[model samples]
Target: GGLSNLLFKCALPEHILSVGDEPRQVLLRVYGAILQVSASGAGIPPDWQPPPRPAAPEQLQGSGLCRHLPPGPGLAAAPRLLRPQGVDSLVLESVMFAILAERALGPRLYGVFPQGRLEQYIPSRRLRTEDLRDPDISKEIAVKMSRFHGMVMPFNKEPKWLFGTMEWYLKQILELTFPEEEQLKKFNHLKTYNLQEEMKSLRELLESTPSPVVFCHNDVQEGNILLLAGHEASSSDKLMLIDFEYSSYNYRGFDIGNHFCEWVYNYTHDSWPFFKASAENYPSRQQQLHFIRHYLSEDSGRRGDTTHEEQARIEEEMLTEINRFALASHFFWGLWSILQAKISTIKFGYL
Candidate 1:
């Protein structure tokens, strides 16, 4: 049998899999699983017949509930999981975010399995760094992020401090064992700069900043934003945010700042274990204003209709806040990279 037939036989349940059926396209591979996604109207082979639809699960069978429950919107074509190994803890966080953000911001959750999850396969392309450089696209993203931050999701946990989390990760990196030569090379710079002192300073600066605490995507690199098809230049829903593994309630400015900082790193090359960071490529003051203005105005529902003086004041405050929190974003990712350097096998620069 072919690869598709084999995947169908091994991954799908007996009631759902039919002999000789082709599997869907592999949408993504991450954290030891492949996301096999199918479109709703894809044509099946002429000789193939689908298996009978199974009865609703037992939980949905009680109290005439099945009758009132609306039919799922083509969830049968939802993405399936192909995990040859156990799920990672970070993958569980992805599952948690998908479940919590369903119909709110992120992708819809179709089902969860011991090995992985089934999700609604959004037809989209991962955004490029240049796409984010477009003024209209940047504004739309700001507005969408503002709307997301404003929502009161059902999560009940206390807001975690962004700086505190960075410190925790840094501590973990300190505790890990490393080869003598590797330790000498990586630790020499830290010893010279007194990393503990720098971290303390960062903590103080972020704590002193007056940013509002809101639910944040935490990681907002270009790769996480998907550009959907058939959108006009100004459409708000053109870009969708994905990958919520590091999402949490934190200072709102941190999200915006992290995204801005992400512009510096280019991960497209085949160069082994290294990424290019050009300081000159960072967004300029005008660009930052362009993004921050949209974020602030949208959150306020003004959308640039404010008086010139009012707009200026808002821009000034936002610029100050974002600049300060950008430091926190840098520190957070810097520590995360250190930890990834020790454990991750992916050929990306972690230092």
Candidate 2:
């Protein structure tokens, strides 16, 4: 369900279940696409071919780009999640997972290692892009997100996660050297955009909007959401959010706005590039209001037992904040893809 990691479903031996509390099955995640391929040192299969480069930058910007490519063998390797130094990223991630599990906001963590983890395997299926538009499902997601944002985490809460990570990725993009003619051509195209200036402007725009800092899932696209099997669509527990590797304390608007941008993308395409973006499918204002209403209802911190008029004003301000932060989502992922293109040996067309 993710482009950056490889997941495997593992079943425990029959005799092990006698312990009673042991999970019968677990999900194994091997982090870093290229690492998944090289862990065994065999590298990518010789017959596999790299996908074609993406279309013009203008076209991609007009319509978003999504990496929904199916998992494939990879060749090269690179560092995993970008994080601030001093603290160990893997240890910090494990702590976050443990906390979420204790709070019932995410899957239970079974085991953690240098390069991957074992997690509780929820019996569920991923929600598709269109499922986000479902009235009941959208409302439930809003409620869960409200709770997610309310969580008091131990991580730094200065709201620097988005900007810092994006700046790091930008540095990687700028420092990359593509000596191959074709690769250089792609690099040249990327050079046309002043990414540094774009980042500065985006930061200023989002700061002016003033969204609250809170714990965020960071990546809430359909692939990361699972609808538990046997639960009715109206059930409160129907949906679960997974893949918190990128989770951090950040602006609330970035989380919600990034999710809204996902409404226009379908990542399940089976062909080369393996994603489709229909800008027209972006949610209408009415739809946005519906989601916001449910979110505000559950968010006591924001709603604050205020009068209806006060709540209405809050909602109106949030609508503007969310839409503006959507641009930051674009900038964040755009830099990510560029770096992945240079270092990841995964077969997807990151460019």
Candidate 3:
């Protein structure tokens, strides 16, 4: 059957189909190409094909009660679908994180497939960069993040991608041979800042202020945060985090720091300078304190009744840690961009 027929069988509404008009084709074009390249690299036969689509859609079992309905006719059921991306290990990690996160605090994972997995399609507005600065929204994000960190799931395998640490990413970047002098010159500009010494300083600070390890949504940028439509501003379930591909156990400060760093870059443009960062965009000291308060309040059970001074002291310490971890975020993504500049076909200023 054709893609349209498949959507009809799933009972998806016509209006829903009109939006994201070419979702399936886009998914196939992007992930399909990546899968083919991955298969070729793995020595798979040239004639190999992607896993066949299931005869029937599978409904998600035991998904928690829906807090708010979609704008159109409420979906009768959320079906699991194939995700045509990544190798076996990567696929497994993605499924594992999705399942664990769903059960805990993130998006609900419906089912797993060989190449792709199924997820509950949430109809919500993707947060704008300005929204991150909103105190109410930022507090909701902090609560959700704190809840995610508190989850204790069992997964023994190490993650294939680790954005919290700088070593692996830096190694990958250093190994790449830039094809043009311009690229080399951009890299040299990065080197002039004495990033190696900065890396050492970051490591020392992290070691000095050791944070408790927890499951982290390593990529908590504005794009990943969704504000549910038709929900009151004060609703606790108003915000939901998506895309767990980079989710893993890491330092708590790194997750918070990475999110703050994300606020500086705008990735909406489709040009050479796809993203621009500015120091003026970083969260101010007062804003950081407000965010940290919400974060620490989630674990109030352990703190017992505390004086205002005690709470203020706690916030001060967390702010210091978050400030230090901000450096690690810069180092991690700086190396990632350098490596992507070499391998990625998509046009963007990775340097």
Residues 237-350, candidate 2: write the lDDT tens digits: 788887786898999999999999999988667876767889988889999999999998898775468888987898899999999999999889888777666655555666
lDDT per residue for candidate 1 within 265-305, as digits (tens), equals 76654585545776786889999998887787777753436
Candidate 1: residue 312 lDDT (0-100): 93
Candidate 1 — which pairs collide?
none
C-alpha lDDT (0 to 100) for residue 13 of candidate 2: 47
Instruction: Give per-candidate clash totals.
Output: 0, 0, 1
lDDT of each: 0.59, 0.74, 0.62
lDDT of 3 by residue, 1-351 (tens): 111112211223334443354232111001223343343323223233334433442432232221222112322211111122225545656666566655755555545555454455555767877889999998988988888888765653343233323554454444455657998888878767876677777678778986667888888987778788889988877988866655777888889999999878877555658667777889999888888888888878755878999988878888888887888788777766665565444456767
Taking all chains together, each candidate's TM-score versus the true structure is 0.71, 0.83, 0.73
Consecutive 10-residue window with the lowest summed lDDT within model 2: 53-62
Question: What local lDDT does model 1 show for residue 340?
Answer: 47
2 against 3, candidate with superior lDDT:
2
Cα error of candidate 1 at position 193, Å? 2.3
Q: Model 3 lDDT vs. the true structure? A: 0.62
- Give residue 193's lDDT in candidate 3 (0 to 100): 81
TM-score computed on alpha carbons, candidate 1: 0.71
Shift of residue 104 alpha carbon in model 2, Å = 0.8
